[model samples]
Target: MKPRILYLATADARGHLMRAQLLAHALIERGAEVEVLTTSDEGATFLGEFGIAAEVLSRHYAVQFDERQNMQRGATDGNVARYLFDPRHMLRDIWRLRRRIAAVDLLVNDSFHPALLVMGCLPGWRRKIVHVYGASLRRALLDNFQGRLPNWLARGFAAAISSELRRARACLQHDFAYAAPARVAPRLFNLPTPIALAQLPQQVQGPRAAVYLNPHFRDPQLATGLEQGLAAMGLQALLVGEGYAGRAGWTPRDPQWIDAAAHSALIVSAPGMAALSVAQVYRRPILLLVTDQPEQRSNAARAADLGLVHEVVCWSGDARLFAIQVQEALQRLRAVAIEEGADAGSQRARQRLDAWVDCLLELAAEPR
Candidate 1:
């Protein structure tokens, strides 16, 4: 019988699913049976669009956001605590997943901690287990210790999450030009951004900023001043998000992203792995929009520190002042060069994953 692999992907962000979809397809082509389990309605639907049918967990496991639309750790912990307090929800989740695992030969988790607790760590699981992470709780804790959260609290949470990561036989992190992770699990593979190569535009346009905003901070009111600021600077700004989805010269989605980037002088967006990948692919300059999320803020900061991005700004909700800042970003974009190597880095990561999966299959076929 062919080895079967089960993947539990959290619907926390669109990028996570994008990365998982690419990997899943690669594995299937390499001759393994794969099943995906998600806890997101949107993720399940998105997976279907790619011709991958995934089972949606009965319970809603979507990340809880604060009023600011940033992920709130307290709310997230409370959501997970329900399973501990209520035996029924816990048992139902376990039963459903266990039945799916009846013939599975390996477990692969894409940052889904609940599944690790429910299934991956179970005894006699019969195959190699792999854990994948796009972002790290430990990295967040270390980065935000002095700024966002108290040091003790950050340490506590980071330690807890880092401990849980050790459950898998191996861990793979999708990263790029990053500082060393705070606490890496044993047998961890700190790979580069797993972006697929694509054609980039040879001739580029000028004086336009491609705005790719995250859905979390897609509020029109918050962006109103920034929009006005861009207009004041005489630069054409095209907003790429749900609020501005599909209008003339505006693409409110990632599908239209490369085309939009081709028409832009620079890209303005929160720092997301996928957005950064888009910018990398198109070789566009980036102007970071600081948001409440630590991941985005840190990514923007780290990129700037590495000289990959031009400028990073926090919205002051003042159009006149912000316009001046936007001008500065424009100038910076023109003055610096975007570092080259993502294509080579991503290619190496793909080869590594393929080799690892092949090794696992070969081991499973060996006699005890």
Candidate 2:
């Protein structure tokens, strides 16, 4: 019998959907039945672009962000509070999710969602639940509650987080680097970013830049500044992101973006796990466009410490200054050495994916 799996991916950014799509395709290839549910219509659209069908889960919540991509703490808190107070909507989705969970052999939650996190604590849910998220996200969560909140509230938050982690059958925390996987805890595994690449057609590195911005980045001037910076650097830029799709100089969504990025002279993107993984895998120099978001800020700092980032760009409400930073970063990145072939990085990604697939199959086959 085929192992049946349900995947719930949050749509705060496209990275979650991208990971879900990749894992869904892989599991299907491995003879498992897979169903994907996303938190928002935007996630469904993103999956649709890649020829993947997804259903939108109702009453899903997302963290709020500002126009410059800064996380809005008070707004997000209010949104969550509203959702928590709406028992009708909350219970409706929870009941729906519970039924789906019972039907599937396993439920994989990519990143975190309030509905799944709530369901995870219920009886009989842990044996069938597996959590996947980036390491930086884990760090940011810890940072949020440590010495930043009231002592009693911080402890309460920490305890809730601990409870959720304990409830999961396994936690797959992925990070950047071409390193060996390690067992961080009895049920937690620290693995390389589970990115699988397709065979690339023979192509040489070109004098072009590949750029991607998530939907959270809403500043129009940043987009304008990016163009000016690339122009100044004498590099043609191929921009891909849902946020900038219809804008002038922004290209339509291309499934072959990985190929373009692999062969480009430089890569530019927000320091999301997906972008960072791609940069490391292809051994391409990257300029990280960071914002005040804790997860992204942590990722940028870590990447720089590891010598993985070639440059870092932060917007201070100055488009001209932002452009100048980008230009200088690109110039510096040009001098860095890129490996002739990405055999090592590809191997690491493949290994991570294989490990995840193996774990899923193993869990699915276990006795109920």
- Per-candidate TM-scores read 0.77, 0.94
Per-residue lDDT for 1-368 in model 1, tens only?
77677877877666676666766787788787888877767678767766779887755455676423577867766787785567677667777767766667666777654656445455644235667776533366445445447788867765655655665566666665533332254457665555544434434345677787655654544566567657766777667654445434445455445455644677887677666655654466777777567677667766755556557777665656776777676776767755453344345445545654554455445532
Q: Give Cα-based local distance difference scores for all models.
A: 0.62, 0.80
RMSD of each: 4.7, 2.0
Candidate 2, 1-368: lDDT as tens digits: 99999998888878888888888888888999999998898788889887789998864488888877889887887787777678866677788888898899989888777777777777887778888888888777655766767888987887787689778777888888537678778778787777657456335444888888888776789888888899999897788877777898786466777777777787899888888888877788999888888888888888866668478888888889988988888889988877556566566667777777777787788876
Highest-lDDT candidate: 2
> What ranges in model 2 sit over 4 Å off?
145-148, 201-206, 342-345
